[model samples]
Target: MGNDKKSELEQWLEALCSDPFSSILDETVFRVDVFETETEYIVESELINCTKEQIFVTCENDALIIQVHENENINKQRVVHLPFPLLNKNIRAYFTSPILEIHISKEISANHPNRYMITIHEIDL
Candidate 1:
């Protein structure tokens, strides 16, 4: 069952990255980090030109921690713990700063493929 879930997640991620919307911000600079543990994985992303835009983070089977920082100051922090097993869950964190930080953690099964993905969308000011 765990392997199946992971496979589904991988497929979803592939499709997401293949989508035309995924490459819409190629001109912008973004940073993505994927960290893996024995039973969990962490994904962190820092996006530029994200002020006044809603940042979305998704995971398959764990909790989400989002922190917003501006000018080296912490603006807002939110943690969401999901109950049910996530096939694909989307959580949005709003930021009004020039720089935005997003962190996501999810449980990873040994039988499942380990991967993380980050997507950014530009919102109208």
Candidate 2:
């Protein structure tokens, strides 16, 4: 009780209860960049302050769900499981500012060539 005799609201409640998870420890997951070239398959997300109706992109089973309605009591989801399976009617999305570029279109892009980088791995049966 002796931090200069406390009470500035008890030193702001001792600096907000001294980190009880530090406000959920920042970063509620939103940072992605799954690259590829020669024919597309690029999904980027930064979404500063977010918009485009609070953002929402989907592709289900072959994964690529990046939702962020941010209200109605906070709901921010992210998932990007794609090892192959893109070109759901040739996708394309762009949102300049803080980036949100998704341009997937490669079902067999003439048998892949330039840059060719699409590797997603996660296995845990």
Candidate 3:
């Protein structure tokens, strides 16, 4: 049973990598790391060239917590603790600048048998 689950996860990751939207993002400009704690999901990211820019991070479900740190002069940071577990499996975040844009999305679809879509948009901030 464990091997089956692992195989399923592998296939899903491959599909995400081949997604059209994934191809357009600047993979070098943003970094995402997921840390699993005993009861929460910790997602940390470092967004480059986004200091003074408006950052928007969202997840499909409202249960996951968020913490953001801006590498600016003042060292701005924000932490949001979610009320429940994120079950939608369509988490995303967007950062926009006058000349550059960054968007990140995880969990393209739910763990169910149906297909779902996750979209990210970046506009002038």
Candidate 4:
């Protein structure tokens, strides 16, 4: 098999492993990192050149949803699902220039069986 053409599978695999982050974020949503400490979950995101009114955050069914309303036609949405339950009321978010950080308090109590939608949290940039 000297210098023969590569199979379709080989090409697909090569593309899959190359620049994985770019492939993941084909949409307009910003990338984020969510990590857990002993007492809380920290969500870090960077929204450069974005105002406080353009950003929205909420939690539902253990999922943290972030929406950046750019325009009427183009809105970016990102969601992060928590492994364990979190206290919705205790959740807090902060914004300093380009950085948007969210802190969710860890909840070890009984889970809320009902699905509830939280009010849109507008970050103060």
Top candidate by lDDT: 4
| TM-score of every candidate relative to the true structure | 0.33, 0.26, 0.32, 0.61
Clashing pairs in 1: none
Candidate 1 stretches greater than 4 Å from native? 1-6, 26-37, 48-125
> In candidate 2, what are the lDDT values of residues 11-85, reduced to their tens digit?
543563364442342245666655668777677777677666667676654566766686753467666666555
Q: How many backbone clashes does candidate 4 have?
A: 0
- lDDT, candidate 4, at 83: 55
| Local distance difference test values of all predictions, in order | 0.43, 0.58, 0.40, 0.64
Off by over 4 Å in 4: 1-23, 26-28, 72-74, 87-89, 108-125
Model 3: residues >4 Å from true position, as ranges? 1-8, 27-46, 62-125
Please tell me which model should have the higher lDDT, number 1 or number 2: 2
Better of 1 and 3 by TM-score: 1
Model 1 lDDT-worst window of ten: 108-117
TM-score of model number 1? 0.33
Which candidate leads in TM-score?
A: 4
Q: Which residue pairs show collisions in model 3?
A: 63-84
Ranking by TM-score: 4, 1, 3, 2
